[model samples]
Target: MSFLHLLAKKSKRRNVKLLRHLQDVASIAMKIARNGGLDERIAYIGAILHDIGKASTQFQKTLDVNFRRPPGMVFRHEIASLFFLSLVDEQDRPAVIEMVVAHHKSIFKDIGEMGLLDLNDRLRDCFEVHAVGFDIWMPNALEILHHLGLKVNPITKEVARKSFEAAVSYCEVKRIGYSKWKGLLMAADHLASDMESEVGDILPKLFITPDLNFYNQQSIWYPLSFIPGNDPRKHTLLKAGTGTGKTYFLLKRCTGRIFYILPFQASINAMYERIKKDLMDTDAEIHLLHAASLLQGNGESLKEKVLQRHIGASIKILTPYQLASLVYATKGYEALITDLAGCDVILDEIHTYSEDAQALVLKIVEILYSLNCRIHIGTATMPTALYNHLLQIMGGKEQVYDVSLPDNVLDTFDRHIIHKAEKIEDLGPTIRDAIKDGLKILIVVNTVERAQKLYRWLNKENLNVDKMLIHSRFKRSSRRALERLLQNDFNRKEKPCWVVATQVVEVSLDISFDLMITDVAPIDALIQRFGRINRIRNAHTIGKYKDIYVLPPPKNNRDARPYKLEVLRRTYDLLPEGELLQERKLQELIDKVYPEIEAPNIDLNAAFVAGKWRIRELYHAPKSALLDKLDIDTVPCIIESDVKLYELADNAIRLDMEIPVSYKILSFKNFPQLKIGNHPFVIPDGAYDVDEGLIAASLKLESVQ
Candidate 1:
């Protein structure tokens, strides 16, 4: 018989042949299984056979750009792949079914009711439809599997039908909890599809152990550096203020691969750059993982960008949301668990999380502990109650290296004087005087609208000094540009400028300004904002203090969103008006503001509870419902003019053009949307300003350029 040529994937550039794609997936799967402590043969066999059903002419025709299926015509290749289950041993058949059955769709309660069980109920002839051309494709699939080193036996259509029936029976009787087998195949399949032939070269570079000797150097200026990190404890919890070398201290405590978690994008980016530069001499593969991580890799090649996203870097800097997927059992979670097994994870700024986020972090800590990972937590403003709770979770003092600075040492880090103002307008005279004195001024606000209004007001003053505004609403590329200016130009000690920003300036920025005039936020958030002023602490500057003025809290809940009104009022009352903001007293003041921390009631939705997995064994959640519960929904959008470039550009460029918009805003306004890569909605061009960012209130549909 003539050899049948089948395609597995098609892009605008080229078509990927089924045989080559399977080989690549199998090779990657084998390596992952070896590293993840799974059965390598099971992974390889599952990967090789995962997409064999694509050989059916029905699936092949969909590869054509002009081909469109009839309405309500549902053909699932994964369901079709199950017909050949008899090719594997009966003992291994269950595992293979888990891998191939729902690699693309869920097994039960899937979104749109498109899962296999749903298909079975909706289509009485589902088996006949999927098995239409199985007889013709069986020999071709067997030949391909045999070439890939799998032992294949000739089987008739009837035998394959029986095998499919048995697999369906097995799935129906399967127990609860997600399947690591499914996660393995999904991870391998995604990598293979994205990297194609390059998967082999990248597989070996994963799970690298980094050299952390650079952080071993001790310094008298940084007190935390004087303490030893190589203690016998399994975990470390360090309580120290900003600029005390907490990052270096936490890094010193790590012994394996590191996943450094930060709460903000600015901080994560800063840490990634800092670590990459510090470890330039080592051959460790350091990667930055986040939504805008690609924007951070401006000069890097496409291969480097691809490498940054894949699992198993020596040091991966990211936000907790990346790891939260494991808690929710999102797709590819098994691969995450496999990579994170026995690694060192650093959770920096643990106090910055909201109530719900704090509860989620606690759950993540529990899961990390179960995975045998050494957890290191560093914080400048953690409440006493929360701190003690974490201590108990980590098995108390016996198992953790709990470190804190003495009161006398903490007094030496006092760098700001606090003053209260009635409103933002009250600081107009002070801002002008500071500008006249040639001092760099930092203005922080509670909302993006306030920041923009303040920047516009300052622009009208004609102060003849550099002025810039930064918030989270700008396009990714524009945000990168603003961040560069903030770090490179405005940060210079000799340069006097005005920077008006929102809460984004709170953490991870290495910039220091001469003075700060800001809104009143939660005590912990205010403490972080104060860190930006006079941030460069040293032996000579210990006693010196820069001034930070706090404005009164907004009255209404709408104006004080993203923070509780009661908390803001309490934080304002606790401020030491016209007095030195003593570093030692901050802990007491913070505790007073947040006396009793409330544990969020989110465990009912979590997949892990009390150190045990609560989800089904081989079934994954249909969607990230936890994100919805947390009210963390954001969608990407582009201006009308950028739609053409966005559609034609590659992933990197498309990411650069995306501006993150709150899903609430889009839904409320009912903005017209466009479907393309990322499905970014379209906005009127007039609604966006390169300098001012999205003008939501000024949006008009008539001028959609």
Candidate 2:
């Protein structure tokens, strides 16, 4: 048989044998490295030598179906790849070896297991066939090297041998910056291995900016009246009221690939669809990325989804958690960081995140700044302190284009009349009256328990109106369905319904209502909830149905965990009563509610420093098979009560039904009950409601301990 043909990789799943998957990886790695402006030759060499150990007969036998594999025999192909490093020059061997070993796992972690501590026995164990003393794989390795146009240099052979022998005691590999060089090789390997089927590039080719001329010329609904008019290539800080075309403004200002980040999946999904529809030009691909991104019927094949990770589309509408991969150093985060460098990012609705998330968001800003990303922050409720901090990071006000609506323009956009009450229970009669009056109502609570309770109470009252309840805990499929229904139902001109929800409805969802009643939350969150009411206004309905009812913080301190009680109290005290909610006062109110720039109990600088250190520390560590552990915060789990229901889940479609069980929930001992096979189920029967979603109390299951 020919040497090149003998070096082929046989895939049991696929019906084709490649000359070698390593060659394909090398080809792809070279392309990626050149595109990233790194040395393509080094990348190709690293890719070619990465899996040279698989050429061994013992490894080949392990691939045979009928072969009896030994129990304790572990074939570390990566370690074997280093044996042929002598084929390369002495100057390039260390970097090439780092790429080979660090591709699958970190070199720092697997050094002992890889046998750098005992070179001769390790070489014998890896290369010598069972019961055979001589290395038989060397001839095939030489054949493969000859076929790849690489000649073994006699001078470097002795040098490589000395280097390898010296490494038996201690191996010191040179530091290749984590985000670029090594990351590029890993990304190329992943992209090549996963690109099983043929697919076209779906990346966006959009460069046309959405200036005032485009908005005025394209449609009458979105007139260019109250948004920042700046060049798409500059850094921008935009402040505009709700319903003022902030999304349009952000999109219009992006000159390259865009990462439109929002706080909620509901919001991100909404933005994804909105951008996809508005652009409807086949020039660019707009992808929605979140936990349940695949489940959203985009008709993306498994191969396409995997490809998109390495070669991102023109625009990605995702939550900030997706960017958290960089901080966590998740596998393939290198690809994400590469995609994000020098890209235009829009951090929309920046005021709606939690304390921890808010801290992470700031840290992300720091990282993106260092990566030279053009960040445009848009928020209606941004505090002066936070804006100033971001401005300083972006090279101060001179570098950032500050965009805000004029006082008269802001007044014209004023559409909300704010009012406060001690409790929502007292507003039951008023809510019933509004339903009779045919006003669409939005009620937002701090917790799912509170939302479900409010939903049931209204149901028991026999309020004759259509009701839809939404929260975070619903099955992935159910939440998606409800979100679509809510969007469609609310858009209908004559629909007068009640949507009982938690903070899920705060940002990104395009639905607007005539009235909103929400529990006491942080001032910024309250403002975000208020944005949902009187959100879509016109000349005829400028100030009509602009009423919003806010319940004051509870007298008891127990309910304050979801939000700071002091902040809520201060926000409630400062809100205008029976008067137009001025947009100018938003920053002042936010500053007052959050006296310190950082949220209480969150040290932003400390978390950022720790994250920076961890990224550096993990650069040489072995790759973890469990990527979920590297995820920033949440843990996704399959939740189902019935064994039959869980059994019905086919492997292909099961991910659509999975839900993220927060880390806080999993920390409790025996907290979740019922397991379908090996996967943890968050609740048993009666916990997940078709309408209200997975009840918060049901997550605390305790039994069969």
Candidate 3:
């Protein structure tokens, strides 16, 4: 049948809604003419015949009154029309085919990697168009075969190629009314498919509208001067005190999608709460994905749908290792590949990673770079070695600039309390004294075994053990549960306890302690761990000052901890006595200390990663491999709702209080002590509550005297 006859049949439905669509198409064509990509005529011609295939009876199966059919059937007419157009002429076929084929996808090619990605100097470009190259599509030759004495035009190879180029050109010119043509077709098509009773089938409908203007409100991020240079393509190394708001800086300036990666589930929980509070009014889809976010809520994939809906959101909160999972991913990476391209990534607490995990992240960064992902390394106390690695990963700061807090704002850092202890034995007493004195303490220890030992000891001391112990020994679910408890405002009667933790607490968990008796380490790490205490406002200046005490070595210490421990021993030995170390001076001290550690290559990029160990390495590349063993698989990640994993711990001390509508996420008969602390945790004990928070702070202590 002739193309005209098909359009005539289309009009028979009484509300063929496309005539209005034709006008819309004409306006778009006019815009194209004025702006000029190919000629205004190409857009008009493409728009007019975009749905010529609606001439087919195949679409009538679903197209009823009000077009109660889905948009797909009607949209297919563009295919038929392209075939019809190819029958006109070779040259016309190529050009017409180009416009028709590409018009529908609204293919965004010119915004090469979100536009201004500097592909000329950076990773990649023009992917959307390149993804549809000439090899994939060819211009069709115009030819007609008489079937039943009727003329039929067939789509040929040449038609595909021209249509592809025209599609790209449309985006390049940003044709004045291109949105109108696209909108009209999309809107008409949807109107045709809508189940309206009165109106007949409509054309596919699309409209042009700007995103909501809510992002423009100016807010105070920092002293403003502490903000880093805004180079999206360059890597930035930041080392600040906790309250300096490193995450806040990264999140605030983050324009496109953001990937905030933390090490553990506990850290993720703390970061998640902060992000939720910060983005409460904003439209960003802040995801708390780990093992928990993947939980199938309400029996329907409502969370999954939200994930899909805003996969390209303004901001996404996730685990850093999850991005690591993607680095060497095979199946799940498909959907995420495009989303991650050119995205800005903020990795918190890099030093907290174990040698194994650190190796994984280093590899992850390398892969992200190849994928055209922009990275911004954020740490409360970024280690010297890490800073160098980040600079290298960002391909060097010769092109990138650094921004830090001014000495003046940093000098105002008389807010912290530092106490030097000689041994780990000294750590407990110091922290106990501080907590008894109403100073919430955060203690950072080197090992998981040590964290557990400290927790038990502090519990024996009748210190509130509930506020203590955040480490890897506990299941991730338990760790997240624990962080929530620590962050809550306990009653005046209840002891606001101290947390004894491994490095897990240092990086992303948002809770803070009043006084921290941390074993000293690198200056950057010391500053980061201090972020947990008095983070929001100034220090509490009542009664005894809640000082962030750094535990010093014994009077005659023999064995000290490892690198972290050694760093702390050296730094702790420097303090004469109680010193109110400011953030900037400490930062300068760290700069001086880590000079040897601040290097990109780290001596062996391939060797450190080449060891044999725990994590199951599955996906492989030339020099790197995906550590599958470390990966907590999301597919089987969830256990039965009644499984013991979700059940409360047996020894948890129960506290009966009306949990807030928000806080009461999971409730049970014997819920593990997320916040139910019976004994008191001494504030002076600080971040190293033994098993709870540590490593992330860059601290360690003398083994013994």
Candidate 4:
């Protein structure tokens, strides 16, 4: 066989001869394996043989325009790769075979049920004689191996059959489980496959950062700047105030690729811009991930999606839940986990998630810790119990860099005066008075229905201020418009206006108000809400300490599904009324309200625990459907009357018209939906006011009755 005849097909990303793919992948795997302290030779050999099966005639024919495989002759080159494992040393054979067979598919799956992966049945026909000649294709494969400086004995029917049996035996031994070598092979293959024509441009290094100190120009608070930079070998946990430069602090410690996680999309969108503009000193690549990642208007091209998922980047700004897909072992989880292993993960605003989400976050921390990832957790509010739990997860206190802001640094950020209110409506006079005084005011409600109701009441009063309303229920396009307005006008506004919002405004938008009125929530949540008022830490402002009125929570448990009534009561009682809201008091209040770990229900936990030991679970790439059970129920919907909006959604350029509403009010299965590409756009037969957003169809039907 000719040397070139043994080569695999050319890569779609670059025009190099296919032989280079295996060599490049081996080089990268060696580097990664060495970094993780694993046997680099095993990694190198695993990568070298991963795609060797592609040298078979059947696979090459698939590349031919006029050729097709004979009926019942399926192409499963990953399985075919096992036929070449005879070249590997017996000691390294298990690792190499595991990486080769599972490179494209799972080794632990029900191979007997999979048509292509069922080695016993699928191999018989391929090995059988054809009209032209004997169908054994190992000659070209061995020639290619020899060209690459490897020697393999001749392939006989008995030798090939024995090699396949050895591979299956290695998989049956669960002691091997998931290995870093396998992860490295997956990462290396993706990186090599994505190399653009010039292979020299893609280096064997880990990640890139600018040489200059990016933090020197900003006036960093004490302790924040004083904390030692991260040691990639250890884990880190930190607590600091809102305006204390925590984001910059965390970025300073990152040694390799970064995964900066936040809770909400609005926060992630805002952070994506901040990182790109301020933190990026070089032309380092970065990607934004969320439900709207595929949205077109964000300058996202189809090519970028391929590059982002496989080629990866130096940094990625996303929600923690995006990384939680690994727990479910979702499709492409291996690639995601490979990119994350040994990387710097900055988890911000971790206290804002729901109970199930919180459980999932802790699971993520446990998994990332096992994967040798450098975890840096930053929080503005964390209960002592939760802090201790995280420390335990990192192997007691010794293994983690436990850092917090000094008292002097914390004292400077004390900017709020708290007051208790009998009812939210009772604060209407206070809001009107603040508006009359030409003070920019922000009112935060616990629910979307309440936010809309309050907005309508305030508009009817006609307080003569430019008023705006925002909540999670607004369409994606409308929410973006509203966020833009908040950033442009209210963020540093010279004029007075009232912005009524829900908890969506709590975490990441850069808007500061002269005064705030909010419903009673957990102390941690309340602190996040209070952050929006006087957020920039301007000490000498006209109103040095802004006023915040906390309305009592709903009287009954039924109306308090969004928040825990007991926690809210404790939060209200512990807050110092008629005095400045000390950031230091936040920890004490949070500890009293949430002392124990919050996790998903018994059933969900059981499901996760049951699959924990099943090796097949790791290979099972489930869909996003797994998230439906984990997330707080919300459904994506569009207003039925908006024809132009539907057309825009159909084009899938921007999802500004799709909004997420409570699934409790709308049955997910009953909605009349349209599939635009991968996204499902639902049309609800309910009155949708520009200001109120989507009214639940069930509510509309009840009204009609």
Candidate 5:
């Protein structure tokens, strides 16, 4: 007798047999469940049966390269997979349903409205449509299940119909939050499909504790390194200046996998590279996570790219936005929670967040604490009230290892002399003198448009200096290349060059310059910007003050965006002119500028709250309004010419051809968009350049061909 063949995934380059895919998913799911303290058997079963619906002839036909899905034909494999729920025990049916019913979509209020519940409410023959030719496929699915060590009996159409009804009933009842079962299966399925034949070899590498002995090296210059990291406290709050080995101390505090959270992409990228280099000798897995992580890769295999986005890295450096999904209970949040549970999370530069972001970070801390994650926070400047709040959130002083430098050590970190300028143009002669002296100068603007304008003005001057401009608007590939040059070439002590950037360079860039000219920002932000200049402090560089000029705050509200005018004026007034910027006085100045930190008004949208979960169980938030409220850029766009290339290229290449833009700005412009997977809006080719980034304001829609 001949048996029918099935496929879980359609790949012309390799064998994607259904049974092998099921086994691969089951193996990964079992590992994840074990690490997250969930029931391994349930996870294994859910993973195995998640894709059994692919056994249908309809789905198999669609897998063919020449196949074209008929118009109005909606076939959900996940919904079809629900027909096999009876194969599991009655007690396990609920979890199995949760894993199967909505693994690919939301049960209710899905963005596309294609959720299981949506289809059930709209179509009277939803089950009947999925049940087409069920008799022919049922035997093959059972045989495959039996071959995978699962005991199976003949499942008739009546039995499958009842399973479908049960799954629909399970999804009908309103619940208070989301389920982890779906996330567990989704994560496993994604990993198995991505890793393919290499799943077994990669499984053992995940969730392993990294060897942190590399950070154990102590030196008198770095005081934090000498302090004992293994304390009785469950959390740590370390306050130290830049170049004081705070990162090393934080690493030394971790006893498990580490999630290093920074504020900006540039900083996260810099930290990712730094950590990978630091742990290069060990067999540690260091991954970078963000919107453009794939672009940051240096010839990493496809498997490595997948692993970078997935959980279980020894050390994963990412921005706080990646973790915000958990706070809002967005899709795949349960998987994130599962991965982050009982891990060491280091929140570096906690003071760098906006008012809304501050509230989000506080909530993130509460969630991490509930998950029993070892939280470590490090900051160069933190307001007194904010410091107290974080201490309270971390269970007060008893549970936290609070570390701060003494006045003497802080005095050694005094590295900049403040100079007030009326405007950037006012310091033209000073900038020229610095350039003539062969000094590296860093100019930081408040906005991308202003940064671009400055780069143009500098170019017009015809200055004989190596100049480069960097902001958050460039394409991923270009941005990655620029960052590499910023770190490798311009950062050299012997190289004297000029770099014009925005707030992206304000935190943790690891670049030092001889001079800095910046637009006035809030006191805390200005302090962070100051860290980028004269950053390398040592016995010879101690107490050596570099000149830093600050331009007056913008006159208009639109120009002074992203920062409150009152705070900017206060910061300017408090800045000492023609004198050393005292390291100890920074907190006092920050407190003066922001006397009291107001709690962000995001409680209404937040899923997790004051020691309780506000959202329903087994259901996720439809969308994250909090991200919009916080003013984060969540949209991607590409040049018009790249549309064809984007459609043909794989994920990594498509990401390279795309540019990240603010949704608020893009929507306001109302540019024509293309719904090709990533939903990138197509802009005129003249609007973008390889050297310059998105020129949205100068875009002429009619120029598009």
Candidate 6:
């Protein structure tokens, strides 16, 4: 076969087309423009021509999938791109070059001279060009051109002059001086292929199909049948048991489209993998709203361009915060929210919100409704307060379907009896006993600190930890590594290992822990935790001692203590031994135990007036405090607040799926800049850091502001 055909076979494995590398530049240009870096449209065109070198037959063969950088190719590609642009009209060269030079995440170097140009309204002109050497191409650009049957000189000093002028203009506007001829080509070259659109694009398109068994049973059918295709007159609420497939129904019920909004990154990855496996066979183009969703691809140029088009996607999976970016950060949120309009939303884990967040959700609900969006709530034990809040927000209970009760939620499965621990120390012993009895146990705590403590204690006694503890605070890559290990061989394994975790395991980590020991928060929450146990049908046998244990509360004393570190308030009333509560007891337990009712402090009647706090703040709570309240790993992250990220999508620069994330907390250093994902975000108590830096608990913001 010809070399080009071989390339096509290789390219066939990669999603998207090759010419699109230029499109990555176009996206970067728009990002620059929208960000007010440069006024010239020509810069945008320059971004389109920047990666022309990738078209070389020689370059494509040299790429190895091991993620090694292409040797000596960055400047060659840049010069090739520049030479291609030079072949275009002389006037169009500047805008294109600006896009090209800055496409590899270093355009801010030009912004120092532009002095923070506000290119917002009508596109403004890049006034002054900062001087940088432009003669950047190597011997191959000329040699490859000669080989390709085109006559071209190595980009000359004069041609480099114009390119350098445009490149300088880019940095001046971003206001930060960039390194001169620093590994930019290497940076761009590192972004080797168009892989993001492959599985990354497949995730949103996948959905769970409601089985024939689901409809005959009210419990299964009600939640499983969001049926976004139906009348918009009714609001939908699903309170089915786990393994009843709350997620599947949420995904499958879209009428014209579906939006699966999950609470955590693990869920995001799991859901993405599921959708890619399931729906990618169909015609739909999928989109992921979260930053991770955007990063998982191979062809950097192809991924970059697809990200720019939003891929005209039919399904979008995301976190609520990505949507919140609209009201808070730079322009990226605009695309996310507009996409959210007019779609069916299966909001999983609706009970996870705080009062402030619930209020904000109410506002977002109104916005979605106003835009004719459909809403579906999926949770295990629907919190009364949250349900009631939705009732008031979406109109009323009768107006929305009442598929919340266990009888109506999903009839396909029987409820597993849940027990409450009489004391805290009973946990390790109980977990150990469950494991010895061949039951895989899950120990979920409300805090990462508590989870770590339990895992440490379990290890001290040498109890199995194969699935011990997982939380948001652990390194992201490491967390992913562990989840992969636990999921594949969970059931067929030997010793019982405890997965001590925060809420991260609750949503989408597919393994069923034989039993769970957890602290209580809300009824819906408790039910969700229960979902992780006995998930599949034929869960625990009748004679089996396996069941969930809600840890006992600390003795109530009025010393201003923090309520015994999330000790369940009405534990005695909810469960007695392995016996399930009877109906009357259940009602009383529901009313008295869970905090779903309007907290006395937050008025339900007043409703949120214009000035009332919003739901977006759920993501805004502090690290320590948030850690105190929920089960998540505390780590630094370089959020997409960087203007460069948006610039690539905007100006059409190539997208590399492996965008770096800080495992520790971090702050944004500049627009398009975020804290790297491997370190703790350095945040001060009094001063602000970057656009959307690590939001420390001490610093409070009322809204996305």
- Of the candidates shown, which would achieve the greatest lDDT relative to the real structure? 5
Clashing pairs in 1: 176-616, 176-617, 177-615, 177-616, 177-617, 177-618, 178-616, 178-617, 179-618
Tens-digit lDDT string for candidate 1 (362-476): 8899889888899999999989998988888888999999999999999889988899989877788998899888999999998887888888898988888898999888988
Q: What is the lDDT of candidate 3?
A: 0.46
For candidate 4, the 10 contiguous residues with the lowest summed lDDT are 126-135
lDDT values, one for every candidate: 0.84, 0.66, 0.46, 0.69, 0.85, 0.47
Off by over 4 Å in 2: 1-20, 61-74, 89-95, 110-134, 138-173, 176-179, 199-233, 328-330, 600-633, 639-652, 666-682, 699-705
lDDT of 5 by residue, 1-705 (tens): 112367787763565989889999999999888887789999988887888998888788888888998998878888889999889999998888877777778777777778888888888788998989999988888888888777899888899989999888877885765577777887888778878889988998888899999999998888888899999899999988888999999999999999999998889888988988988998889898986546565588888887988868999999888888878887778778878889999999977888878888888999999889999999988888888989998999999999998998888888899999987877788878888898999999998889999988887877787889999889888887898898788888575678899999988788889999999998888888998998886777877889999998887787788888887899999999999999878878888877786667677777887877776555666655655556666688899889899888877888888889887666756677877647788788888877669876867767766
User: Best by TM-score, which number?
Assistant: 1
Better of 1 and 6 by lDDT: 1
Error of 2 at 388 (Å): 0.5
Per-residue lDDT of model 2, residues 1-705, tens digit only? 244544334442452223456666777777666555668888888787777766666556665668786776665665556667767776776557656655665444443454333334554633332212114555666667666767853323344345445333224433334536556667766666665433223212222222223332333334334444565436888877677777777766766678889998788878877877777754566667775445455465665455434544677778887877555454556667766777889999776777667866877787788777889899988877888877887777777888887776666666788887777889988888887888899999998778889889888888777888888777677787888888887646665688889888889888878888888788888888888877776667765647888887877667876777777788889888888888767777888877668643333322235224344321433334223333344554554444456567643255456665565666664544334433545455555667777665665454322
Q: What would you estimate as the lDDT of candidate 2? A: 0.66
lDDT of 3 by residue, 533-604 (tens): 665544343122346666654333333443355555566665536766655666456655565543233223
Q: Ranking by lDDT, best first?
A: 5, 1, 4, 2, 6, 3
Tell me the deviation in Å of residue 493 in model 2.
4.3
Which of 2 and 3 is ahead in TM-score?
2
Q: What is the C-alpha local distance difference test score of candidate 5?
A: 0.85
How many clashes would you count in candidate 5? 10
Task: Spell out the clash pairs found in candidate 2.
Answer: 105-622, 105-623, 106-621, 106-622, 106-623, 204-284, 204-314
